[model samples]
Target: MTDILVSEIMNRLNSLFPSVSSELNSINDYTFLIAVLLSAQTKDKRVNIVTKELFKVASTPVQMLELGLDKLKEYIKTIGLYNNKANNIINLSKILIEQYNAEVPLDRDQLELLPGIGRKSANVILNKICNAPYIAVDTHVARVSKRLEFTKNTKVNKIEEDLYKVIPSEYHTIASNLLVMHGRYTCTAKNPKCSKCILKDICNSRNKYF
Candidate 1:
């Protein structure tokens, strides 16, 4: 049953949105990591807005550290939790320079060691930058997974485990992007667009309050 459902979701998502990658506008690892950190509890569009100004001045760990927290905060103040985010970015930058030779660590464990970087953030970095098969369960992924009856578990970790088990190995990375886009545009939190959704027939949450 899980396999059948997974196949259906994969087929529909691929047909609807064929391309799936990080929508962040960044040219380097440092900027990418900063954008990911800023993305927590924030929208990608807003992250792009803040990162554009921040990256223009400081796109490297050394440059960021030299900018100092106060100035950094000033640049990213538009983002939610800007204070904490700025602190984390600064500290993470310092650690990067001291430990990874100013490179975003590819290893999940090493990446998680940095401030503000949790499992989801690490997974996104690995999947997007390293081309690894990791499904990062943000709010969208978790909500959509349960609504689709892909997992009974509400916990983020369990949802991730269920998805990994049900999703085909080839579609893991694409699945993350597809699910995220689906949640953002179709299976929305407030009012889902089920009428226009291609997966409405199979969607367990169709016609139900989102």
Candidate 2:
């Protein structure tokens, strides 16, 4: 798509989702990081359901360590990959306390160094917390970007790179969340609600369901 079309898509997205943000429920920075980590391969609704109880008992790194590994697993067992997630959460919590004084790192490199925090997770943290211009390409973001012709790449990193090049910097921070919301609701993988979509007139996807 041309830059003008991309700009119009962004404008529509911003108008549709004026308050772009994650749906994961978190009380603080520590809980927010943990919520995002636990959200891997899991739905935000599921993550929120588990974290509601998990955070009550262990909202901080020190509290997480005190909660112990096995107990933490019990709380998040309903989530996929709970065993590995529990282990990473514990280990990352230790790193946070020992290295950063129990504070979530604002730097992308430092955040990525934490257990279970990949580029996508780090991008989310940096964008949401630090208000940085980083687009975290999740499944929804990737699908929407491809269908919109914002990118032809299948790899998330490449898609993110394409978005950075295509989307104006002013909308960079909100791009991921906006696209995520759009894909999750309007431009779904199965039978997308193209008729109700703001970009329906412009979108020429084969999957469109009018």
Candidate 3:
């Protein structure tokens, strides 16, 4: 799609989904990071349920260590990949305490250094926590981007680059969340609600005209 088309799509998306929200809205930075980590391969709703109890017991790095690995696993065991998630959470807590003085680093690279944190996770933290203008490309965003012809590249980093190049800076954060919410609800994977979709005309997906 042309830059003008991409810009129009973002504008329409921002208008439809006005609020900036995340399923993992932790009270503090420490809990927020843990929530995001636990969210991998799991639904946000599920992650929120687990974190509500998990954070009540341990919201800080030191408290997490005190919670212990085995006990931590017990709390988040219902989540997918709980075993690996538990291990990473514990180790990452230690790293935060020992390296960053138990604070969530704002730098993308620094945040990515933590266990279970990758480019997507780091971008989320930077955008939500640091208020950086970054559009984190998750499964929903990636799928929506491809459908909208934002980029043909399946690689997430390249997709992000393509989005940034076309989308206005003012709509960076809004655009990401908009596409995510759209993909989550209207433009779903298996069966999209194209009839009710505002971007139906602009969408280049195979099912757009269906």
- Best-matching candidate per lDDT: 2
Runs off by more than 4 Å, candidate 2: 206-210
Ten-residue stretch with the least lDDT total in model 2:
201-210
Candidate 3: clashing residue pairs, number: 0
- RMSD in order of candidates: 1.2, 1.1, 1.3
Candidate closer to the true structure by lDDT (higher is better), 1 or 3: 1
lDDT of 3 by residue, 1-210 (tens): 777887888878877876756767588988889988999889999999988898999999999999999999999999999999999999999999999999999899998889999999988888888778899999999998888877889999999999898787888876777888989998888788888889888777847446
Candidate 2 backbone collisions, by pair:
none
Query: What is the model-wide C-alpha lDDT for candidate 1?
Result: 0.89
Per-candidate clashes come to 0, 0, 0
Write down the TM-score of every candidate: 0.96, 0.97, 0.95
Where is the poorest 10-residue window by lDDT in model 3? 201-210
